[model samples]
Target: MTEATVGEFTTRASSINRALDQIGDKWCLLIIQEVLWGINSFNEMMAAMGVSRGVLSNRLKWLQEVGCLRREEGVAGSHRPRYHLTSKSIALYDCAMMAITWERDWYQTPALDRVELVHLPCAKPFVAQLRCACCDALVCLRDVSYQPGPGATRDVREKKVRRRSSIAITEVRSEHALYRNLINVVGDRWTSNLIALSFHGLTRFEQFHQELPVATNILSDRLKLLVEEGVLEQVVYQQRPLRYEYHLTEKGQGLFPWFLTLLQWGDTWCDPQGRGKPMQVTHNPCGEQLQAQVHCSECHGVLKAHEVRFTLDGEDMNP
Candidate 1:
């Protein structure tokens, strides 16, 4: 899609989509991960991510423009400047933690298994759990409902004829990369909205289009991308005219926690005036209002931003 088209769609008040548009590309998240790991220099990022220098440069520039990252001068007369995560980007720790949790649970591979996260306070390898902030109950997909918010707009424009990019972002892959793969699957706003809608029981093309206010062309492209990524499986519901329904595969369902984290974050930070959080979640099993919270699986204590540290294959990263 053209830049104008992307801007048109993202103009809507959906905080999740807006957030995705800013930092949802394969290279963006990987860059953030590198910075979080203390690999901040441009040369260091290029060497570690194996991306073209041009791509790295573009991604970094976009990230800085969005205020997710900032550049600082090097020490003394050093040539290599450093990029640091702003508070805005640092707050994404929950999202990244949830992604890693989902990757470990549903997409475990030899490469993923080699990396581990340790909760320093707990002194043990830990998993992240999404619990209700309201009642400390587990939050699931079936517990939430949404409506239009104050920022909601009915500005869906007529479809514009456009050519697809010659190189689709979804077709790009990184070597044994977790965050890149996750972003590749749900990189764009439309694709992320489609996945969120699928969790709401909207499966068919018309259903997704109705709820998302996205162009049919954009919706179709996202659906095809999801199916290609094995997150959504397209099944024929009717043999005549080849009617099909998209269903979440096991891998897709595993993304529930990540989405929940995003929703909670949006509600807390993005909405502010209670306008954007049009959804209310309830813990179905416990019959209480839900606000997802991330906690350490080992100690069952709340996972605060300052309490966690990283380790790579049993070595402390001190990150």
Candidate 2:
């Protein structure tokens, strides 16, 4: 379908959309990850992420402006200031865990394999798992429902949507970086938005275009990329004229936890109008509003940043 042929449809300026608007770029996410790993200085992030100095500086300022990061005084004699995660960004820990879980499930990430996530409460290395806050049952894509909430309102699409960066996250030089594949999929705003919409049961091309309203070519390209990455599979839904519908593969559904955690974080930190959450997610099994919690697979305890230790090569890394 052509962009002009597609009809205008109302798209909610949901918390997730707002959230993506702030940190959806590859450079922005890489910068955040670097800071999370305690790589704080401008030079450090630039070198570690293999990002241009201009881009790194811009993303750092943007992150600080969005409240995801804050600038702090340099230590001792260092003249360069440090960037620290705000409470808003620290809350992204669960989302990060979910991303790691999905990455490990789909790819043989050497960096992630060498690192162990130890649940201090359990004192055992554990994989991250998502469970519903209502009944503690595991959350699956099929067992969830979406409903419009108080803040449901149309987003004003820019007449000229800013084009996303073409640079791949895999191009980043950080061998210690986790979630390279996940970042490649979601680092672009359009790709990430499509993934989020899939969780709401959007399947057809027309349905996706209505919610996203990007140029048709851009939409098509992202869908094609998703298919190539094994996150989506195109199913023949109509025999005539070769019409198809896109459905999430098992790999795609595995991303539900990451998006779920991101949604919750956005609800908490990205509501500019305080209109309340734009969407209400219900856990079908428990019949209660879905509250996502990332926990240890071994002990089933909710994870806390301070209570988890990351070990690399048998040495404990910083919390």
Candidate 3:
């Protein structure tokens, strides 16, 4: 019950939501990866990215301000600032590694980007479940359980965690093997662009293509793949000639937290990449500009990831 040291993670648990918010972005994780891999100087990071100087600077500043990095003086060089990872940032390496693994397996197309990943001790890829923990079935987050882990320390006075009886979880499964599955079914495409058009209500076929001037075949393939995975369902709103629109199912929309996770990560660790500007959402009745905060089902208290517990007995439990 002592306080966690620099190398250890807390077992009591706190803000799982905030932890998710931090490393969940495509850029933040990648930037952090580069920084951890000895790209400590500004010029080094810029060279690694090949992006705009402004973009690189902004991401570095955001990560530093959020306490992931510290700007200390150079040891004996020309007196320039260097970035070093905080203890918290170092702990996040595992999560970032996982996300990168998913990207390589699921989203990758070229041999250059399709690098393999593995965990440290096991030195193996995907030795864990790809499905949601809440509902043991093969599904994404929408109807899934997302309680905190053991090492949490949430703001109990401001938000209380509640118990969950039989939490809702979505089930999913795909027969694909030896690949990084699509961990980000909703937002983010560092190598590509998505969601910005969708958020602007661009559901039509032409609008999506026009907004993102990528190859038509690529977009078509992505769309078809998403539909097949049940992330985006093509619903026919009009019946006369059968007009269809892509709408997010529960599994897709369940990623709103992941969406907020990415947005906040971008805000803190990446530049406002034209698309990465502010997106303020509000509760309709309360008018409160809402950030993504999880609440308990029973008491409606704001939840930390670990305070609640789930039982295995349910209608959709996986064997």
Candidate 4:
């Protein structure tokens, strides 16, 4: 089905097959991951993805048509076109990275070394992180709070969603958000922002409310879902009357990179503040100011989003 048709599936009256379309197929998401990882050229993607030439071509064409990847003529040579992430698809780096990190964890990989984003200002290895524009503080996935924004929806069952704990951020480990570990969880507006705030360490229930005036019902649902998924677990905070606080399990904390990747994309294009330029990320350890820069895994050097190229490694790569 067409993407426009597929979109209706996620909303009310959407069918199960339509839902799959919304998430896209293995080819689409994999192509997305390769671009974010700095594989920009047609050959480079074919090499890395290792899909059949027919499959690769189809997937690439589909992605290009769907507004995810843009085809650009290479400057150096007269050859096949190169693909770059459009602003729209670049915004999905969160989902892409989340997919990659999840795959790395569960799938067998010969190498486990991480490609870190070093803060240019301090020469420190700074991974992407969320910081409050107001307080200028580091936000961990576990510490932030959530309230709905303009795009909030009541798709899930309506009710006053409540937190299982008093505090929203915790050190405990849980396994909820990573169960399927796709980008669908924080796909909505407030969900990502809420989770981002917690990463910045704003976890108290009141703080979540103070920072965000989301409907009580929506917050309750998101919180419950997070709890069920093990992203957050209720902790007994008070003894006499019995109280609890929401803390990020280790499983949740590892998602920091994935969330930061998304925030960076959003801050880049979605933000009204000069395209969110002049964005600053600080080093959690040194407290020194920082910014994230990406690189290619094979090269171990900084990579331009559109500069890196791929080859099929002697295999067909068309989808």
Model 2, range 1-319, lDDT digits (tens) per residue? 0012234344686778777777877777777888888898888787888877777777788899999999998779988999999999989889889989999999998888889989998899999999998899999999999899888888654433555555677777885579989989988778898998888889999999887767799899999999999989999999988999999999999998888888898899988778998899999998999998988999999999898998888887773
lDDT of candidates 1 onward, in order: 0.72, 0.85, 0.44, 0.48
Best by TM-score: 2
After TM-score superposition, what is the CA distance of residue 95 in candidate 4 from its true location, in Å? Answer: 6.4
Reference-based TM-score, model 1: 0.83
Q: List candidate 4 stretches off by more than 4 Å.
A: 1-95, 106-180, 273-279, 284-287, 296-299, 303-319
Runs of candidate 2 exceeding 4 Å displacement: 1-10, 157-166
lDDT score for residue 99 of model 1 = 86
Candidate 3 is scored at a TM of 0.43
Ranking by TM-score: 2, 1, 4, 3
- Over 82-149, each residue of candidate 3 has an lDDT whose tens digit, in order, gives 88888657645334333433444345434214233322333232322222223223223333223332
Best by lDDT: 2
Better by TM-score, candidate 3 or 2: 2
| lDDT per residue as tens, model 4, 224-299 | 7777766667788789877667776665676675655544554444333242222345554445543444433333
lDDT of 1: 0.72
Count clashes in each candidate, considering only residues at least 3 apart in sequence or on different chains. 0, 0, 18, 39
List where candidate 1 sits over 4 angstroms from the true fold: 1-12, 149-178, 210-221, 268-278, 285-289
Q: Give the TM-scores of the predictions, in the order they appear.
A: 0.83, 0.93, 0.43, 0.47
lDDT of 2: 0.85
